[model samples]
Target chain A: MLTKRIIPCLDIKDGRTVKGVNFVNIRDAGDPVELGSAYAQQGADELVFLDISATNEERKTFASLVRDIAKHINIPFTVGGGISAVADVAPLLEAGADKVSVNSAAVRNPGLIDELSKAFGAQCIVLAIDARRVDDQWTVHTHGGKKATEKKLFEWAKEGQDRGAGEILFTSMDHDGTKSGFAIDPLARLNAILSIPVIASGGAGNKEHFIGAFKEGKADAALAASIFHFGEVKIPELKSFLKQQAIHIR
Target chain B: MKLAIIKYNAGNIQSVSFALERLGVDFHITDNAEEIKTADKVIFPGVGEASTTMKYLRDRKLDLVIRDLKQPVLGICLGMQLMCTFSEENATECLGIFDESVKLFKPTAQDQKVPHMGWNQLRLKDSWLDPSLEGEFIYFVHSYYVPVNPNTAASTDYIVPFSAAMKRDNFHAVQFHPEKSAEAGERVLKSFLK
Candidate 1:
């Protein structure tokens, strides 16, 4: 059986991890590779390193960091953030990232999705949609959810899939950071309409929330940051709990 | 062992090189037919479209070299698919190392997704792969699969039972990415290295 994946997302800035990580055994919390290896050791199904760096030099450093991570961590990982053009992706993939997620740039230029999918097989291109409910409609947001776009969630997601995105990483801005729960309705709808896998992101506070994402949202995978980093919810314990709940966790 | 990673116009070759480096094995990535043919072991790693990659392999005449190699040759992902007789992906013919046809995955259930991405357990049926890896999860990412055949060494279930790993004489192939499958994956690679 294909198991439901549990992913730990780490934010990278200037070649180092940002946002406080509370892993006790970590020698350097800023080291994304070490932290990523630690997470992989704890049975993280996969890892996502979102490079939040702003400058070109920092992006170079991030690419080098990706090479180091690939050399050390055995698990598959995705690299995202600041990936605007097709050229920006090769460096990351060449550095050994399994997948590369494009957000704001993809929204601005929908053709970018097609080009990316054509260049690198659809399996490596992840379309990340950040959206929030507005006027009873899910409106897509860009630039890390600060800027709003006219595209609606479902239509844009369908378009992304048609444009050859292998998977959709949908992050509900409304429920994000609230620690309340996942945006079940939207996630369920995305799965219902699209044939590709949908990874539910944001609003993962506890283990039950993960269960909800899998059971209710019907998410192929669930991703969370602070909860895993702060040791509030360990992956092994979470997987065991999900298994007890009859969820096919790996 | 003099290991040579067969390099073609495919993606994710770096990941395999890194995996070998982690194992502390010296290897060279090359398209040289003589180098690949003379190596003790050859790793054919790929992540790309089938027809195009097959064309690239044919253009360089690496196809003939690969077909003639007598050493242990392991194929990964598209490399595995190309080892088969044919592929439903763009209707391209393959190397015919394995007498099987690669077909696209058709979802029978609503939950079954294409690209069959993420970790899934393997059912080992041969000694080429470590028996300890039985029921252990490995990473896979592909829309096309080679169905179970006599060459199947390991099997996995998604929409249907498919060949997770296939072995025929000297050529071995796996649909999963052992380079990215963590420790269990490392063990599989170690088994191949042995």
Candidate 2:
């Protein structure tokens, strides 16, 4: 059986791992390579690094960081942020990233997903959606949630899948940094609508939240950052907890 | 021992190189027919459309070269599919190292997904690579699979039981990406190296 994946996300700026609350007030976590290696050792099914730095030089730094991480970790890892064109993907894959996630770029031009999935195969393209509840309906937000688009969250997700995105990383802006738990209703809706895997992100305060993500939210994978980065929750401990709940963790 | 990974336009060969790197195995990633022929072992790894990739290989005449390799050779995912007799993917003819046809996976139920992405157990038949991998979970990601046949070294069931691994003569292929499968996967690759 395909197990439910527990992923630790690293938000990197200038090649260093960082975490923030609700996309602001960022703080340093550690070196991305060291942290990623530790997560793989502790049984993180996968790792995701978002290059929050959207500059050319930092992209180079991120590429080298991916190379460094791949040297130490055997499991699959994904890199995202600032990836726009088809040319942006090859260097990262060459540096050993198994998959690449596109958010703002994909939203701006939905065709990029088609182009990417065509060029690199469907398995390598992930569509990361950052959303928040607006007037009782989820709205797609980009630019780290500072900007909101007219696209409805559910419709946009479906379109992304149609464009050949293999997976969806849906992060709830309302639940993010709050630790109040995932926005289960929206997550379950998204999971039900898409045949591909859905990874629930944000608002994982305790072990129970993860259980809720898999059980109530119907997420195929759960991604958390602050809790795992700050050592508030260890991956092994979380896996055992999920395993006890019969979640079939990896 | 020198190992050569047959390079093409396909993506994700880096994972294979990294897997070999972890095992302390040195290798060269080259498409040169002579380089491939001289290697102690050759790994054909790819992630691309079969028809287009086959055209690329045939253009370079690497297709015939791969068919004649005497040393142990491993084909992964798309590489495995291309080594078969033919592929339903774009209706392409392949290297025919193993006389099996690749077909698209048909999910029987509403919830059963195609692509078979994620970890599943391996049921091994006897092979020099390792029978101990039977019942072990390995990672797989593909929309097409090779049906079970005489050359099948191991099998895995998704929507149907299919060839998880294949062996005939000195050519071997696995449908799964052993590099992405953690410890059990590394063990399988280590056995291949041995």
Candidate 3:
């Protein structure tokens, strides 16, 4: 039986983990490798590292960081942010990233998905969409939610799957950082339309929100950042909670 | 013991290599016939279109070399699919290490997805690979699969029950990626090398 996955996302800026993580096992909050290994020890199904660094030197640092994390952590990890072309992917994969998430790049040139999917495979390409509810419809946002595109959330998600994306990481900007809950309605909407797995991202505060994402929103996986980074909700405790609620978790 | 991963035009070899590195096992990723034949254990791994990869192997004459490897061999994902009799992936004939065919998943229900991605449990049968992994959740990311057959060492249910692990004589193949599957997967890989 396929179980719902729980993923903790880390943001990297200037070769360091952005959100300060506080955990007894993890002493270096800035070190991604230490944080990733600690999360894996706590039974995080997978980890996503979004490189928010902009400079060329920091990109090099991110590469080595990815290499180091792959050496230390046993679970799969994804690297995202600033991936623009086919040439950009091999270096990261070689650096030990299991999958690479494409957001603004895919929006700029959708053919990159097909090319990456061809060179690698669909399983290695994750299409990430940052969306915000505009009026009654959800609109796609790019540049880390700075720019909004005409692409509707559901339409872009469908296109993502059709263009050979293995999964869709749907993040709601409205719900992000609020910790109110996930954008459940849109997540369920996206889940209903797409055949591929939908990873619900943004706005996970407590364990109950995770339950809402899995049970009510019908997400294949729920991804959060600060909630996990701050040690508000440990992965094992959340999984146990979900299990008690009869939700299959890994 | 020296272990070698069969290198081809495929993805995910780095992840496998990293897994081995974590286990403190030294390995070589090569396409050379002699190097593969000399290794104590050879892992055939791939993640690409079947027909094109087959063509690449045949062009390099690796197909013949791999068919003759007598040492214990393990194939992961696309490697396992290529080890079968034939694959519906591109209507291509495979290495035929196991007398079975690979076909794309046809989801029984409407919402059931193809490509069957994510963590799934295995109903393991007695095998030398690892008895502990029986009913253990492992990672899988593929669309095509081999059906339940005589070679099946373990079975899993997605839309329908399919072979998650297969074994025949010295050849062992798994439809899942043990390299990416964390703790339980590390145990399975360690057992395979043992």
Candidate 4:
């Protein structure tokens, strides 16, 4: 059986690991390579490295960092942010990153998803959707939750699947870092719509939050930043707790 | 050494070559039988309907060359489907290197997803076929699957049971995308290359 994945996301800025309070007040955690290795040792199933800054220099940093981490870790890592073109993917994958996640760039040229999926194969491409609840519907957000896309969350997720996106990492911006636990209702809606494995992000305050995500939200994986980054929840302890809760863990 | 990716009306050849170039492996994307026959390894990859693909391969005599290769060969996506006896896609007859048929994945009790798309786990069957492939999740995206048989080296669950990876002697194929499969995928590729 494919074990339910436990992923810890690292918001990288200028080639270093950083965690913020509600996507603001960013602070450096440590070197990305070291931090990634630690996560792997702690039995993290996968890692997602988001550049978090939209700039040429930051992208280069992320690309280089992905390569650096890939060389050291024998697990999958996805690099997001400022990835604008097919050309952008080459350097990062070369640097040892297994997959590349596209956000604003993909929304702009939905065809870019096909192009990248075709160029790199479907599994190499990841579509990261930042969603926010708007008027009783979860609407897609772009530019790292800065802009609202007209595309509904599920509609676009199905589109991403059709376009050959390997996985859907859906993050709830309203619940991110809130520790209110995942917005189970919106995530459940997405889980019903997306045939792909959904990585639930945001609003994880406790171990039960993860169990709720896998059970209530039907998420393939649960991702947290502040909880793991701040040492509030140790990964091993959490995994044991989930295992006791009968949620499959590695 | 030159490596040839047998292009039987499939997806990107340049992308595979790009990955090879990064790994410093010399390769080419070719449909020419002579070029494929002479390469160190042959990779057969596909991204479209299998019936149309088999028709093209049969027309070009590529099917014979694929069956006859002695060196390491890799098949991805539909290419993996073609390596089996037949595919459910368009009721197509495929290269019967593996004695299994690709069947459609219908909506089942728990699995309502039509096209099983995403990164899923591979319960690698421990066998001499490929020990390195055991227990890793390879990325997958397919609506149909080759029912688990004696030849299956790995399996996954979607709408129903599906072969995540298959190994038949020198002719190895994976339903999941190894090039896209992250670390577990990297390990699978390393095992295949070994």
Candidate 5:
């Protein structure tokens, strides 16, 4: 059976693992390859490496990182951020990434989703949507949660499906870095709207929050950074707690 | 000697190659019939839907070539599934080289989830042991299970139970990735290489 995944996201800056709060105030996490191998050994189902740097040709660096990580670790890893062209994904995939995530650039040209799916298979494309609730409506945000786009959350999620997104990583801007808990309401809406697997990110403070995300939010996976990176919540302990909660994690 | 990794449109060929490289083995990844047949050993690694993978194999005449090979062949994950009779994931008609069906793991109300993704214990059957595949845990990530049969070399449990490894003549497979299984995985790969 599909165990609920415990993903430790590694933010990359200039090809190294870096961590930050609320997506800013960056600090070094460690070497991504070492951190990635440690997570795999500790039973992390997958790793997410987000390149926080803004380079015009940064995708190659991400691909090489994926290759290097694949060389050292033997688990599925997803690479996200700054992926623009359809062909840009091939390098990352060739480099050993199981999945590639696209953000603002994917929305800029939604057709790129279909092209990628057609070439690399749908299971390889993940759409990472950063959203915030405004006026009782979920509004999509772009450029690392700094720019609010006119696209409605549920609407774009639906469009992502039609455009060939295999999975949806929905992060709430309001709850991110807040440590309050997952924004279950919008996640609830996104879960109800999207048929593909939905991974909930942002604002996981404790084990119970993950339990709530699974039970109430209907999220297939809950991803957190600070809790896992800061040694506040360990992966094995989290899995054991989730198992006790009857949430099905190995 | 160079080993050949059958490379179609499957997703996991690179991982297998990397694993071999780690072991200091020279291997070639190719779909060319001549290249694969000429190698010392052949590996079929895949990580996508079964039917689509089988289609590409059949369309490219790989199905025929794979069945005729005399060298030791190892199939990993979806590659293992493609050797079976059929797969429920896509109602896939596979190579049927091995008489088995890939069954879906429909989670019980109390069971975990789909895509069984993690490490699990392995209980080896008496005959499957090549002296190297002893009791060990291997990483697995799939939604289907290969049913137990005469070729059942090892068994593993998830929500219920399923075949973790299978062996039939020159062809052998493990549902879990030996390449990704760390030291234990490295041991099994070494056994296969020998």
Candidate 6:
């Protein structure tokens, strides 16, 4: 049986691990490679590194950091942030990152999703959607949740799947950094609408939140950054808790 | 032992190379038939669309080279799928080493995702891989799967019971990405190298 995944996301800035609170007030964590390796050791099913840096030089540094992470970490990992074109993805994949997540670029040109999935194969392309409830509708947000778009959550997700995105990493901007719980209603709806796996992100405060994400939200995976980064929630303990809850955790 | 990773127009080949590097083994990623033929063991790794990759292999005659190689060869993910008789992916014929067909996964339940992504446990039987890895979770990501057959060395259940790993003579293939499966996955590679 395929078990539910527990992912530890490391927000990267200037090639180092950082955690942003609601997309701002970044705090330094540690070296990405070290943190990634430690997470792997702690039984993290997968790792996601989101590069929050903007400069072209920092992008180069992130690629090299990706190579280093790939060399040290044995488990699968995904790299995302500011991926705008096919050219932008080639370096990261060549650097040995297993998958690359595309956000703003994919939304701007939905064809970018088609082109990426065609070129890199759908298995390696993750469509990451940051969304918040605006006036009773789940509105899509981009640029790290700073900009809102006209696209609705469910429709854009369906389009992403049709365009060949292998997985949807849906982060709820409303629930992010609040540590209350996952946005279950929206996540469940996303899972119901999309055939590909949906990874529930944001609002993971404790192990119970994870259970809600998997059992109620029906997420194939649950991702958290601050909790895992600061040792507030240890992965092994959480996995055991989920397993006890009959979640079939990996 | 001389080891060669057969290089083709496929994705994730770099990950395999890095995995071997972590294992402290010397290897060459090559498409040259002579190198692949002479190597004591060969690793055929790929991640891409079936028809396109098969065409790439056939264009370089790597398909024929792979089919004829007597050295123990291990194929991963799409590499494993292409080793089969045919693939439902674009209805393309494959290398025909395993005599199995790869079919797209049709989810039976709402939770059964098409790609079958994430870590899944394996039920091993007469596998060249480490027997201790039985019931251990290995990473998998593919929409299509090779159904259980005579060559199945290991099996996993998702939407349906499928070949997690298969073995027939010198050709050994796994649908999972052992390179990205961490320690247990490294054990699989080590078992093959042994």
Model 6: per-residue Cα lDDT over B103-192, one tens digit each: 999988888888889999999988888989988989998999999998899999987899999999999999999999999999999988
Candidate 5 docking band: acceptable
Please give the C-alpha DockQ score of model 2. Answer: 0.55
Label model 6 with its docking quality class.
high
TM-score of each: 0.99, 0.94, 0.97, 0.74, 0.83, 0.97
Give the poorly placed runs of model 6, Cα more than 4 Å off. Answer: A20-29
**Which residue pairs in candidate 4 collide?**
A67-A95
* Alpha-carbon local distance difference test for all models: 0.93, 0.86, 0.89, 0.75, 0.80, 0.91
With candidate 3 superimposed using the best TM-score fit, by how many Å does residue B128's alpha carbon deviate from the native?
Answer: 1.7
- Cα RMSD (Å) per model? 0.8, 3.2, 1.2, 5.5, 4.3, 2.8
Q: Tell me which of candidates 4 and 6 scores higher on TM-score.
A: 6
lDDT of 5 at B191: 68
Q: Which regions in candidate 1 have their CA more than 4 angstroms from the true location?
A: none
Chain B TM-score for each model? 0.98, 0.97, 0.97, 0.89, 0.94, 0.99
Q: Candidate 5, residues A127-167: lDDT per residue as tens digits? A: 89999988878899998898988888899988998788878
In candidate 5, how many Å is residue A192 off?
A: 4.4
Better of 2 and 6 by lDDT: 6
**Residues A154-173, candidate 4, lDDT per residue (tens digit)?**
88988998998878888899
Tens digits of per-residue lDDT, candidate 1, B48-141, equal: 9999999999999999999999999999999999999999999999899998889999998778899899999999886589888999999999
What are the per-residue Cα lDDT tens digits for candidate 3 across A1-250? 7889899999998779998777775578888888888898888988999999888888888888888888888888899989999898899998888899999999989989999988888888999999998887799999889898999999999998999998999999999999999999998888788888889998888999988998889999999998888889988899999999999887
Compared with the true structure, what per-residue lDDT tens digits does model 6 show for residues A1-250? 7899999998888987766332212333367887788789889999999999979888788989999999999999999998989999998999899899999999899999999998898888999999999999999998779899999999999999999999999999999999999999999999999989999999999889998999989999999999877778888999999999988977
Where in model 3 is the C-alpha error above 4 Å?
none
Task: Give me the candidate number with maximum DockQ.
Answer: 1
lDDT (10s digit) by residue, model 3, range B1-194: 88999888778788888899888888999988999999999999888889999999999999998889899999999999999989999899999988998989987764577678788998887766678777798998889999999888899998879998888988998999898888988987887888
Judged by lDDT against the true structure, how good is candidate 2? Answer: 0.86
Error of 4 at A144 (Å): 3.2
lDDT tens digits by residue: candidate 2, A1-250: 6678888999998888777423212332367776777777788888999898867887788888888887778788899989999999988988889899999999899999999999888888999999998998899999988899998999999999999999999999998999989889998888778888888998999989988888888888899998887778888999998889998765
The superposed Cα distance between candidate 2 and the true structure at residue B100, in angstroms, equals: 1.8
Residue A166 miss distance in model 5 (angstroms): 2.2
**Model 4 CA deviation exceeding 4 Å by range:** A20-29, A90-96, A108-111, A114-122, A148-151, A158-166, B1-65, B71-79, B85-95, B109-126, B129-144, B154-156, B164-169, B172-194
